[model samples]
Target chain A: MNDQEIIEQIKKGDESAIDFLYKKNYRMMVKLILKNSGTEDEAKDIYQDALVVLWQKARNPEFVLSSKISTYLYSVCLNLWRKELERKGRHTSSEGMDYGENMPYDEKERIHIVQKCINELGDACKQILIYYYYDKLSMAEIAEKMGFANADTAKTKKYKCKQELDKKIKTQYTPSDFLD
Target chain B: MELQEKIDQYLLDQLSPADKTKFEQLIAGDSHLKSEVALQQSVVTALGNTRSMQLKARMQKIPVSMASTGNALRLKWIGIATTGAVAAGLIIFFLTGTGQEKNTESAESSSIQQTTSTEISPAVVPTIESTTPSAESQTEKAEQAVVVKKQKNTGTVAPSNEIKAFDNSANFDDIENGNVTTPNAENSSAPANTLYTETNNKLSNLSVTVDNSNSKDKSYQFTGSKLTLFGDFNNKPYELLELNNKGQKNLFLSYNNEYYELVWGQMKKTPLKKVSHKETLEKLKVINP
Candidate 1:
């Protein structure tokens, strides 16, 4: 199908639409990265990131695609790859900044604990949390995506999921998990 | 707003700067709001990570063909380069086999260059003998002919009197216009110059070989489009050899007892750079390309 139809399917959360886009643009997008000094795995990673970005943006009702989906994906891949290369350069040059060691011990523990708590959440709650907090979707958009009755229902569910995740993490929290 | 909504607004950075400052002060005073915001921040970061992992997993599972455009483009990049020698050989091959009249006149011309010819492989020997035309019959036709003088035509260049072709562009133009005369050649009476027009049977006769073919003897042919001289002989005939060295195809011309490298131009006449370098001339002298 054409860009509009595929976009509409994505807006409707059609998995097949994602599959179609993933297959159709896979070669050219990956080839772009491969030509620009990226390895196959790196190319695949960048293209996937670009696709996810597009998929997330397509969920916004007000998001107008000013270009073809492929063009949008290509631009996204290029920018992401540039950022990735910059990150790699910085990572290589900044030898003393070991990321895990640099972070506060408690903060690292908190992230680990929070990630574990998040994993315990049901798939729907996880999707809702990601849609709102990560993808920055509005409550209404979350409601539409999660098949909630309304924005209020989506909001209540999100708050409850957060509370559940917080409770799970708080149970695991100890004096040692906090800095003095 | 409910405390949770207030906290959500602050956590999402949706609050105005003044409101955010006010909320930060309130949270600073209220440990509970501060704890809630911190908890939510960690959750957001974790959720983002989780979503990325999920999306990445899904993408990695998507099957792509191994023989996709990536490899195709790579192969195309390799295809971008064609060495100058192979290209020039192609040019010489096509330009030399154009005239039908050149084939008929081959019996006279082909034999004249044999003694001084480089090693002639069966494949490179053009089927010029297939087309035989009379010297007198092809007098007018000789002007547009493509000529090749094979090794068998060695007698055409008698060792008794050495022949020196016209050394200048004006004379080269005379040769190009078929104004040269062999005893049996009906083209010219301008002395010394012989029209050696030998046409191969098929234009598909192309070779990508080395220069060692012109190792010994003196035989050369200056015909329609190009002049190829082979072997080393006493007369030191002005012979032009299309030599493919390294990846470059260069024309090393021996004319008027001097060696010059010819650079082809858009027009009929091209400038020849004189080669006084002994090593290069000796090297060129040995190549029977």
Candidate 2:
């Protein structure tokens, strides 16, 4: 069933809708999350977290969906992946990140350069770039999740963080850093 | 479009094909625009790949039990409720005094006080009914009725010694039928309404135990000396008996059929009443006996 039908069933406390939702989107959600630099385990965690948020919010009487189920799921997974990066970055430096560019590049080179640059970037940079570019989250949503003052502040921070990431990559590599 | 905004949107794959062609034209001739695009493109690609890998790893680790979120939440609440109940039990055990001497002495004096106090106020006595079931069903129905009979002129006065005596009788009946499970089960066997002042030292040794396999690690206690004040006096006496369990003094209050652990020296001016002891006893009797 579609999200609306599933949501209606869920509102009635029908158990099957939850199962169907999980089964239907679990793999695609995982794949989307994996594209954001997470492993299968991280993908599962993000998927579950997204599912949890959806399940909890779906119970609210006023929740309305203005997008497709896949879009919503992708957004949630993307947000969760950013959070995971932020958490990991707290204890370590973002040194060699695996993501390469916004345009779909040669998947292999894209994966290698992205991972290497991501490894060099700081937690803050990793989170902002992943949210805006990979997850495609709005600046406002990113700000709210990260506890920033507002969307403008988050956007400013994102710009600074990206510059920082680019600088770090240039210092580490002699070639005109492919990842600006 | 503004230069930075245009470059930012172009790098993010958010720009339209027309804008993309414009960006390509600029990149072909402009060093700064080409450099900006190069940096942002590399960063975005890196982010996407890392996310994809992380998602793949997370998906592989999904637990078999992930579908049982509702059950998990229910179990969490059940654990909390059980912990609250056991903590309440320990509180009641401590407040009522525990050792043999104190238990016996408190049981004896409280019974006598209840009898004399009731005789003094004959008009207030309600019809006495024995609802306690037979020995086979003693644990199932150990109702200790403590009716503090009073005339219209007097307010809801304290229960008499007769009621305490009646509770003691019921307690004995519970012990005889193995209704209680504790080292201090002998004392708990007495009706819940038996009121003994803190003077009895043995009451300190009593403890209530709740053993559930799913229960948590922490245990709680209520000091008996400060709380057992429902005797042959007015309601004001409870205010005096109310002692706060500040800093782990271990005093708990039983009122309205719930146990509250006193914290931060905030003691109630009045004793909290509980759902009638008879009702709980009846429930216990049904479940156990």
| TM-score of each candidate structure, all chains considered together | 0.44, 0.33
Q: Which window of 10 residues has the lowest lDDT sum in candidate 2 chain B? A: B144-153
Candidate 2 DockQ, CA atoms:
0.08
For residue A124, model 1's alpha carbon misses the true position, in angstroms, by 3.0
lDDT of each: 0.51, 0.43
Residue ranges of candidate 1 with Cα displaced over 4 Å: A1-18, A55-69, A83-109, A136-156, A174-180, B13-18, B28-32, B66-289
For residues B1-289, could you state the per-residue lDDT of candidate 1 as single tens digits?
8887787777767889999999999978976666777776777667766876787697677665434323343233223222332454566668877532322322322333221112221122211110111121232122212222211112232221222221111222222222322221221111111222223322112221112265554333433333333443322223444433343445555444466665533233333457887756654543321
Write model 2 residue lDDT over A46-163, tens digit each, in one string: 6665654555455455566544444444445544455456545553543433322233554445346656878777777787787777656678877976789999999999888877
- Residue A75, candidate 1: Cα error in Å is 3.5
DockQ of each: 0.08, 0.08
Q: For candidate 2, give the lDDT of residue B171.
A: 34
Give me the displacement of residue B89 in model 1, in angstroms.
28
| Stretches > 4 Å off in candidate 2 | A1-111, A174-180, B1-4, B30-32, B57-61, B65-289
Over A1-180, each residue of candidate 1 has an lDDT whose tens digit, in order, gives 345767776665555566656655565466555555667777787777777777667655557765456545645565555555555565544232222455677777677888998889899988888878766777888898789899999989998987887788888874234322
